[model samples]
Target: MAVDLPGGVFRMGSDTHYPEERPSHRVRVGAFSIDETAVTNTDFAAFVADTGHVTVAEQPLDPAQFPDAPPENLVPGSMVFTPTRGPVDLRHLSQWWRWKPGACWRHPRGPRSSIEGLEDHPVVHVAHADALAYAAWAGAALPTEAEWEYASRGGLDGATYTWGDEPRPGGRIMANTWDGPDFPWRSTGESGFLRTAPVGSFPPNGYGLHDMAGNVWEWTDDWWTSRHPDDATSACCAPDDPRGGDLEASYDPAQPQFRVGRKVIKGGSHLCADSYCLRYRPAARRPQPVDTGMSHVGFRCVRRPATVEGTP
Candidate 1:
């Protein structure tokens, strides 16, 4: 199902959170429709069955693209999160994230794992191209970063969470974020999931959108910039449905040799924790490489008013 949102102006970033979301500013988006929840395993299976489409994670790596990669590591695989046995250095994410062979959407954990009973969970291990392909097949498009943040705010401008100002209003868990304070090691299992949860497992946002804060990180159409541009000079000057940085600026400076572009990804996943990654909020944003897919990344689609119902 999809929700028809009558978009309007809202605060787009968070100065209170990570630096990437600084310069909290107002932005406007045109009316659009967005999927109520992330695309699920059942949905992706149908698209694959109909189009015989192949996901990036299922394709062998190009040696030229990974000249320094070991020969054995060139096979198809995806990054999977493995909880550490005990406390480890939180600064190094390598402690818990591993490159698991055969860990595509079909096999979330690895070749040994399957999505047999997880058809309703958000599909993971999907790269930006895979998401775009599915959107095209479904006669939809990926949401722009502006449109996504506007929809996620759900009329609560500048609220910390999609629901309200409080993280857990009235002591009720609003979204499916990491359960315990200890991350990458111990899980209290309070959220009822250590990974992706079923769509709509938690309460919907004020906009009738489900999983807007967590469950899985969602791909956006905007290229990534280190931080949001300065706020518009005035309300009338606020950029309408603003786009993000240019392709050249989206490349990671730390790994310039790869020349890979990145896009903005919103909605922190189930792995997000208060102690580690406190990003399960509407304003939080992250940059993800366009060619990479991980076990916690998935996407939903959007449709502008100008788009025909059954046409992209």
Candidate 2:
């Protein structure tokens, strides 16, 4: 089911959170319809079966693109989150993420793993191209960063979470996030799933949209910008349906030679924990390479009402 959002102006970003989310701004978005839940494995399977679409994680890597990569690592695969045995440095993300060969959407854990019982779970290991192809097949479009963040807020203006200021209101888990201590492996099981939970498993937001704060990070159409543009001086000057930064500006300076532009991904995943990555909020955002997919990353689609010739 798709929920119709009566779009309007809203305050976007956070003034007291991650550096990237600073400089909170106001954005105007048009009315649109978004999926009530994240795109599930069953939904993506139908698209693949009908279109014979091949996800980026399933295709072999081009040697020319990664000349310095090892020959053995040139095989098709995607990044998978493997929790460490004990306490480890949280700064290094490689401690829990591995590039397992053949780790596509179908084989989430690797070549041997299958999605037999996870049909309703949100599909993971989907790169930007894969998500775009699926959206195209479904006759929908990926939401822009502004649209995504707006919908995620679910009518809540400046609340810290999709639900409210408290992450776990009344001692109840609202989304699927890592409910554990500082250690990456330990899980409090409050969210009910170690990895990706079934779509709509958690309570929906004010807009009746599920998994808006957690479950799996979703792909957005906008390129990643370090921070949002400053708020317009007046309502008449507010940006409408802003697209975000350019491809050149989205690249990571540390990997200057990679030449891959990143898109803005919203909604933290099951790996998000307060002790570590406290990003399971409506204003929280992350950057993802267009060509890379991970076990904790997935996406949903949205559709905007057609505008009349002379309508604003």
lDDT of every predicted structure (CA atoms): 0.93, 0.92
Candidate 1 lDDT over 148-188, as tens digits, reads: 99989888999899998888888998888888888888889
Off by over 4 Å in 1: 307-312
User: Residues 66-108, candidate 2, lDDT per residue (tens digit)?
Assistant: 8998889899999999888988998899998998999999999
Candidate 2 lDDT: 0.92
Ten-residue region with minimum lDDT total, candidate 2: 182-191
Model 1 lDDT, full chain set: 0.93
What residue pairs are clashing in model 2?
none
How far is 170's C-alpha from truth in model 2 (Å)? 0.7
What RMSD does each model have against the real structure?
Answer: 2.4, 1.0
